[model samples]
Target chain A: MLALHAPASGGARLTAVNVAAEAVGLVIGDRLADARARESELQCHPADLAADRAALRKLALWATRYTPTTALWADGEAPDGFFLEVEGSAHLFGGEDALARDLGERLRGFGLDPKVAIADTVGAAYAVSRYSLQRLVIVPPKGMRDAISPLPLAALRLPADDCATLFRLGFKRIADLIGKPRAPLTARFGALLPLRLDQALGHAGEAIRPQLPPPAYQARLRFAEPILLQEHLIVATTALLEKLAPELERDGVALRKIGLRFFRVDGGVQSLTLGLASASRDARHITALVRLRLERLAEGLDAGFGFDTAVLDGLAVESVKTAQPGLAVQARALTEAEHRARLVDVLSQRLGAASVRHLSPRASHLPEEAATPLPALHGAPPAWLPPPRRGPRPPFLLPRAEPAEVMAGVPDHPPAQFRWRGVVHRVAAAEGPERIAAEWWKRPETPSTRDYYVVEDDAGRRFWLYRDGLYREAHPPKWFVHGLLP
Target chain B: MAPSLRPAAPPPLPLARTPTEALVNLRQTIARLEGRPVAEAAVPVLRFGCPEIDDHLPGGGIAPGSVNDIVPVGYDATPAALGFALALLAASQGPAALVQSRRLEAELGQPYGPGLQDAGIDPARLLVVSADSEADAQWAVEECLTAAALSFVVGLLGAPLSPTVGRRFSLAAQNAGHPLVLLHPHDTAGSNTADTRWLVATAPAARDRFGALGDPRWTVTLQRNRNGRTGQWILESGHGPHRFRVVETLADRPLPAPATIRRRR
Candidate 1:
């Protein structure tokens, strides 16, 4: 694939760099001018950043199905790929060694020139993947620095000029600076190199960083015997929660989100995450959520009568104030909102995270787009007052905004008549043309302008409607049926 | 000095008078759900980039002691809502939890982490959690909210979530000071009973020239809320994930404020 798509002006030709790697007549950074002069037939194509970004994004998207902590090393102009932190599930592809081979083969099959290395750090992995050319090495967590020390300076994610200068200074290997004093390195090469070195060696935090972290809570147990009962797992989790509760409490934290991890005897991590309607650091609250999830797990807490450890995290927490007694609303019955919140959370545990949502109001005049839906667990309170008095709202709002008929009206006047769900309904009582202009103040692509109206049908079914745009033949001022009023 | 930096004395434990003191808040899913109802209180509002978010939250923001989480399309996918949540929490006076994953990628950048702090969450209150598998993610969700320590918990899960799990977690969140927040992408299979499930799609940022999150049109569907009314809220175009601001029910749409808001998606 690389050779076929090398570059083409009218026809195709091999790039100078490939020819150099093949012929050994020259090397990278030897001066493109020099290489061109030596091999007049070499074809050169300027690097395409946009193409690289697109490819990287595509690859990232594909990688995401596997894990959320993938990191790309395609910064700057280097074709250097990325480092995926598959630490926990590396075995899903059949252990680390097999994972490396499978990933490399898969990339090859995808027509990507991929070299993979299972290393501990992003820098080390990048170096091994880039320079290990012949083999994909799986460096055990504790023993990675030595494996990378044998590679050249180019593997350090450093610049070519700096690499050459380091080689000239006899600092050829990553080990050369191991025990050396920092003053000389600082004085000679400035502080950046040392910082980079520390980051690579894990002494300094490289902070590759995840887009959105998983959770912060963790529960674990070191059992004397592997118990088969699922209750044991609960006990183990309780033990770990005991350890974590204090920290959370001291920090004024709560668990709205959590992750339960089970590091089995055979070197594997099994986990379950629970989301809550409210956040708290109380362990029992977390345990209840987990009990429901664990019970439904396909594996069903099997421990072969003996297991090693169980852990939990996803420390999803929220803050609550320590208000003085009688300072807030008095203790009251379970409000409808609270009941619904519990129901939503229970439903999520029974169904899935996206199954439940709350009706949130929107700024759009478009009915379907008028009020938004949010995760029940994360949604705000239900509105207590009446639905918007704007115009006529429909009785039901579909997942997607379905087509509705447009009636004649300018601004706040009720529409004369409209067709909905195939039937035409006549307007009985008319109230408005609640002008819901586009949110143009924020974006250029906003709707031209929308004029929403609330019109009650003769049958007493209040329907919310809106015009997509002001009357215009070119654009056809379309209208839509939005929401329903009780 | 770190010890000296601590407050002279934390006065007294305020929760000592409540039933919570006697109950062994075992990090259970049903712990919060099974307990007596907690009354509505004046909770500190967490301003999501969108005003609609604030509107749904008790007190016009995420009510204190609520559990919430994000579901992205996948790990590599952008957790737009998660980002917005973090920014809101970071700008808050309390701490926030950042759950970690073991499969795909792992790096917590200051540039991104502080985006929440920049908005208003207390950076000092941030917590980081890493779970090895899906089950662990669920357990962590319950654990964080069951405890009265953390202010918020954020998670990135492999699946959408089930109804049972959602209820238990919500219960845990109520009693403790913490709230659970997760990021479940679109691909997270199955159903869930989340208090508010937001279906966030991408839209161009409003003013960010060099790739910043502007006011993206999020198709926020209130899958579950009181009154059985599901709808969407159009957030104004702005600049980053947190830049999208919710527009009011223009002209004359005013919903009766919820008395006790326990969830805010």
Candidate 2:
């Protein structure tokens, strides 16, 4: 026999009792001393509220597989219990009764005894699931009134003191308070009496917000015993992916990002996310991607006792349709491009999203300002103009110009001889200075002007050099090698 | 999924006296016999309208699905190589990709969208991705080459590529029928396997009526040609409707600025 003790007015009281303790007439809320007096051999363990709350939260998140909308039924209202609004989702498991059976069977695997009920109203469902002798009562739509009529007045979800007050008025059953007028009930027991009753009867709407947005596609697997091997995890992942493929296909969408969650037996969760450069729904590709990511983090993903649950979710999705081919010979398989995209997806998974990029040109006159580098999956490519009809822009522009020493003929002439970065170059043929001034309004610090010259050395190597500021203004303007022309 | 059936190829026809008229007749007959529409043969090459530039390139222009290299010859040739890369990207069909490392992007002044747009490469069609290192950039390029969505991919490598990496990129590009142009500084061109390697250098800029700088120009020297003879051309852009033109003269001869004088106090 096991008993959970919590601090109470009478020192400590039994908050919960196992079946053996219950069989011996040890009801909950009884003082610990009284329970000991009744059954001297009973074992009592101090209740850990924090641990219990954490366990409940984990269970709530796990229930998201059955329905996206899952929430705690408010503290004290349903201790260690949650609400899963499985309105349109019950069919996935056959029906509400089947879903309840499956849920109970799976939860029992986790060593939990769960009470599940399906009703049109949350209040009625809560009351019936907890008090019904069957442990599973599914109330059909519009049947909430009769379904909860036999339950005690306490089943209305009211505070304990208020339920006792109603009981004192000879209203022991919920049916007894149903016939009474609302005004008299409020005048005596308060407005909550009728309001709670109305809520349970499905006459008023109750809001239950989801913890997060529901995944477009999701599948979950539970283990009777925790498994630790990476191979076993991969097997489980493949099975879940197979289950999820049909759902994605039905929606005519492919997943861009998939997330895997491992629920360890020690109450810790390990989540890994895999992103694809292109949308895909292929089970083999998805499984491969998962393996690639897992391989990178295998050592760190400690199975700590082992994982009891594995959940796979399609975190991001994009619409995809089969491409039609013009010729049958080429249509038998993916075109070269589609094949390439799939390869990119595989490589991206292994290398990371930062590896794949697209180069876009921006509208700026400054040599370095002319192009924008963007992440492949993020922003759209910018609009393009026709190729320019001018001197070729350097393939690469140094972030900053490197200083150089130069000897030139007369004032502001192209460098006749120069030394840059420890190398001396003799000028063969040089072009004139193309003056480009700083945008003073934008950058006040660079009020100096730049005189750029395209100079080719005797070795056939061309360099874009600039003398910063005028010679008269700064003694001798500093010369810099800004770029190397191929 | 099972593939839809393809109509069989048309039977071979006899040679005709008038080739052009016979070709038209054969195409119409093939279309009629297939009972389905047939598309025109895809062009294997892209011609840059300018004769001087086209005359030097194999097949008279750029190959649609091949690897090319643009190596900067000197200090300021990086921007020229980047410009030529963008110009090729602009001319290529479909979306393009640019893969470089963060260090390279920083060293080259992260390409500004406005500048790239002005250079003629549509900013919208470009997807730029920065890798953690130079090796990663090459790997990214190889991966991006496999994606059929991109018409081409451009990789900026600061160092020479190992034979394995170069071969991998070349094979991937060829298999995917996608072009890849690697940009490397001249000094680092070691054991490159690209079909063509152009040494790009900044040439003299063209002058407008007011003597201001006009369209940019580059002296593109074909350093390595696998299928054609080596040659050099001075390519200019932004003149009239023709976006590119090869000029014969090396210098624009701009009027020199007046000499400055110092007044002693």
Candidate 3:
């Protein structure tokens, strides 16, 4: 939200001359004719709040690597800067001095001529930056006042005209106003001057209302016009995506899914969602993928005099390699397996990645010795663990539904006739006593041994059944449906 | 109404040598489709994990792509209704979705997320979904069970379940190859929705009296199993203390089934 203004000239003129006024005195505002005649050496241009605020927001996002709470306050003629209060929390990046250095370095890296100061109060820090004893100032609590004493009264955050009036009254430095009565000052000028003084001195609290709430990770972008048209919505959404894509990248995050919330000026909310085949950050590609889905949503949009805000949300954020390119081609070839995978991928977007999954086989010979389940957070199974090759498998795994009744021989003998699924099927064909023992290491005292059979009924249906325990035990072997046959 | 089954990918632990070879004999018995001859169809492999339990299950374990249903006994009375839930959920592939009634939150704690994590299943992957009533649980179960790739779909009903509902879930489990694990409080005195029901409670893994420093054990009473045997065994649940212990053996105590069964196998 910060807005940075250049000197009458741009960056090169910044150091050479503190030439702020001569340019403003030139032909930019209402007195263009008179200003032009007055200062022939003037170079004038309209302020670009749009680009400046954009830059500050980028810096704020980058600062998130510092703390989740970062806000930008830029709504005046002052050149853009951050209102970051790294007071108690400043030590995280190695105390105030180191945090200042880091913040300045990062802003510079982002192509902004940055200066930072950590003071007891934001007003004091702003004053230090405006007219300061040192760049990247860190005002330790005990000497915080000394840091701003020599600075001009305007640095106290007063209106330009009021500061001039205060100066004319012989208030040359902040020291001159220290013991002054507040009632008269408020009666004469606005309350802002005294309020700014209290704020600068750390008496009055100065809060920077952040763009987001505590730990609200979602980022938002707004449009200038009240946009009712879908095309305009698309354009604004694209801009937001462009901004969001990089922030997500820096965090090493990919978008498993994202939601776009359109907050209409009329107070209605509409959301559109996109689930990725894999998490990604490329704005152009995400926009393309999401826009197709958005087109289908035109019928659902309720404009209500147009939306003024657009919010892009990354609800499913899994850390990933930020520099990943698009994978639409990888989602190609259209094989049947690939098609099934796409179904799961879509399900993940709606229910989250952890909701969709597959099973892993456990090593055991017991007829019941089979598989375990794990959350399939990743989309494609890496080639490392190749899926089991299609093998001899039953058509229907019996509903471990209910244990069946059977009349059979010995503990391990295949059943001659078994009652399952409420129906009787005589065993026409059967296979041997394949024995499966328990994992004694896991379960020490439990009785073990599974006598399994691969049996065929008279009707050609195959059955997977087992008898619990051994035939030698006094308890008769129990009949259970383990799995089904094709 | 019955839920549909959907096939889902699960962890693929390497198969041991014995089961792989045994599958050769069972291959012709249970092919993927009867329309095709056994020689043409893939071998029907049923991997029943842990030889003991598979001892009673038909076909040994479940067919690789087949689904199953487990309804723990005394779920109605067990304070750790989530114990059976997490046991099954921990072993699932995609995610273990719990479509629960609101009452579960009060007993299991406000947020079921942490408890799920403590039980060894990652809460992030757990979809602790909510439904208004048993009908909703049935609907969600049906939806989850119908997918061809699903591993299991459990419907924890608040009320006693109907045989028709059980049949519906069975049909869905068959289609999707996804197993369903349902939990009902002690109030569920006369309903059955699973192949097996174990009266379960999470207990000290071992007698702390010996200063054992691990998790507790679970005492499970086998109320009913579709295979026609009833028994009680104790198992410790946690890695340290969770060895299941069979304090009382209703195991040898035989109980006649309410009605004679006619199995379709």
Candidate 4:
């Protein structure tokens, strides 16, 4: 009584059929009205194509247990199945037959009706799984020819129109095409006819682009016995880093970001990632940084049963030239820089990386635009010019300028007194108004020009206040307290 | 001198010691019981060039290896406290680290490099770390304090710390032999294990040749000191050979505005 129907060209077609509906002689793609004629009463629901596609993608990712390379296979325009390149991976599960049986059994346990086949090529696998009466089929090398010969011409992955043309021409089975001469077949059906046939017969190469590729710089340690002690885990991590560091050094590269993944015996994975301020190849430095991170993540990493495998991956790497000894002083300086870099690496890992920042100068005249904070490891050393001597800048600049009421004698002159945060401050002394024009190219919608002044209150608290807009404008200028002079 | 090989005869001792000798013996006995050196060479201090300011502190100046607590007296007092800490950092010998929380950074704004340079601490020698939370900032501060490479560590906190956490920081500073300064931006109250506690308020700025605001000044009050001294002084930053100096002519402090009283309707 339960089925999801979509209106097709002819009538209401069953897009999805539930177990109860299928048991009552209902099937997907069947005319709903005809199915209803068979069953006196039937329940109908609407099909959600977007949700179905997302579910299929999730299932494809889970299929990675069988093979690292899995892709969605499309029936017409919709993804109806998954293609797994279990080429050399089947042996881990004993053999191809056992792997296919395990896959089918596991999927069936999850309420999925599965039809699986293992073949040498994608075309043969797709054809036999969908149309063959046998639930499972395993075709050996050069076995696809006899395997797909008796099937309909649609099994060749041809379009419906081409299939009808082939039927009218008395070519109803794949065997009919296998015996025909290539020149005549192409002259009638174009190049695609022979290309698809060759692809099915393993004469042409077919590639399956995987969803994700394995990391290039990675070392894995598999233990015969699971380890639960923190000290043992640290020892295993050190060993893995030692194995991975030499490869990086050979390639003239250093890792700036790395990840440690722990595969638990119960099939759960816990990962910790660390970012460094500079490129480093020293294994001791990496181990120290990872140790500090482990201290912080002690609660989340539950070695449920125990961890059996540990993998270290160089998530991000930077190229560097090998160091050659220079002058004594230069060598000392380099050593100092290296020490600082290591300290920054450990600190960045201890505190979140975003918390450790380095200042980089930006090419702008605005006070706020002069410099910016970037992740300590990611930013290069900053080069800055000497500050202007006209007036002293504040020790701290407000994140956002707070509005203040300014009273002054002249429109362009510095304010005599200002009220900020509900307290009034009388200006004991005043400085010149340095004009700062807004970046019109960047923010043309509201162009504003500021007139800043270094004003000290009666209590000697200096303030950097600015008039937001010029007095020469049609509207009166607004005042704001921008920064504080130490 | 070669003939004086025999021990000299002891002079006739007085029947009783004088009052001054008795007092000296009593002081020595107390020092022994307290487990402190009676006259330990003044703890090595970083001297402010200005004699007046240096003399104000016991042992002549700030103890560079001790924990100094700075409490802001008002909302406008944070800059003063920071300027004072920076001056101390400028006088130290090694690279300095500043650990600040996001809340503190957002409220008081970040430490500007050029401004810090102008204040006399070389921008190149400073490492600024912004933590996500107060606890993270405290942890970073402790960790940096234990780093032998750091000259000193400055931590900015939104609130006061419990005595236990403060003791941990004090112990860490002692172990690393590096100075530590904790800045409490808001006027929060709590007991701390610092050698000295100061309350810094904004004072009048110095005047330039043209009578404009020249440099920042702060009214530093010694709220608590283990050396048994409580005093207040007006000090200027980025001045003198030590980068800070005491102002002789203390500005007149305006009396607090009278509290309003409402009559019963």
The candidates' DockQ values read 0.02, 0.21, 0.02, 0.35
lDDT per residue, candidate 1, A1-486, as tens digits? 111123344433333255344575655445555555666776666656568666775565345334546666655424546667787766555788877776677567666666667777777777777777565677778676787787887777776777788899898888786778899778877787787777667777676655335445444455666555678777777777888877777777666777775645433345577778766555665566567777667778655435555656655577755434565677534444444445446545644555344445455544445444455577553342233444333323333444677567554345788887788888755555667666666677755666766565554344556776765546567777644332
lDDT (Cα, tens digit) per residue for candidate 4, span B68-187: 888878878777787777777778765778888888766678877666656665565677898877788888888888766577788888767988898898778767766688888646
Task: Please identify model 2 stretches exceeding 4 Å from their true place.
Answer: A1-55, A66-69, A75-79, A85-121, A128-154, A159-178, A187-191, A201-207, A212-486, B1-65, B73-76, B91-94, B185-187, B200-211, B214-221, B227-265
In order, the TM-score of chain B in each prediction is: 0.61, 0.75, 0.63, 0.75
Winner on lDDT (1 vs 2): 2
Q: Write the per-residue lDDT of candidate 3 for residues A154-210, one digit (tens) a residue.
A: 788677788889899999888788769999989999788788888889888878766
| Candidate 3 accuracy as TM-score | 0.35
Rank order (by lDDT, best first): 4, 2, 3, 1
User: Which of the numbered candidates is closest to the native, going by highest lDDT?
Assistant: 4
Please report how far candidate 2 places residue A278 from its true position, in Å.
8.4
Q: Over all chains combined, what TM-score does candidate 2 have?
A: 0.61
lDDT per residue as tens, model 4, A1-486: 788888888988998877888787788889988888887778877788778877877777556555657788765523567788888678877899999997788678667888888889888888878767787788877899999989988877788788899999999899998968899778888898898888888998777667546456887776889999888888988899888878998999998888777867555567787878788877777888877787778484799988877878787899988976566764324455666677678788878677777666677767887767777676444655666664556666778888999998667988998898899999988887888889888875987888888887887677888898877778898999877776
Worst 10 residues of 2 chain A by lDDT: A374-383
Error of 4 at B222 (Å): 3.9
Query: TM-scores of the models, in the given order?
Result: 0.38, 0.61, 0.35, 0.79
TM-score between model 4 and native: 0.79
Best-performing candidate as measured by TM-score: 4
lDDT of candidate 1 over B110-205, digit per residue (tens)? 112122223333333443444556666677566556544446677666555678887777767667655556666557632354544544443222
DockQ, candidate no. 1 = 0.02
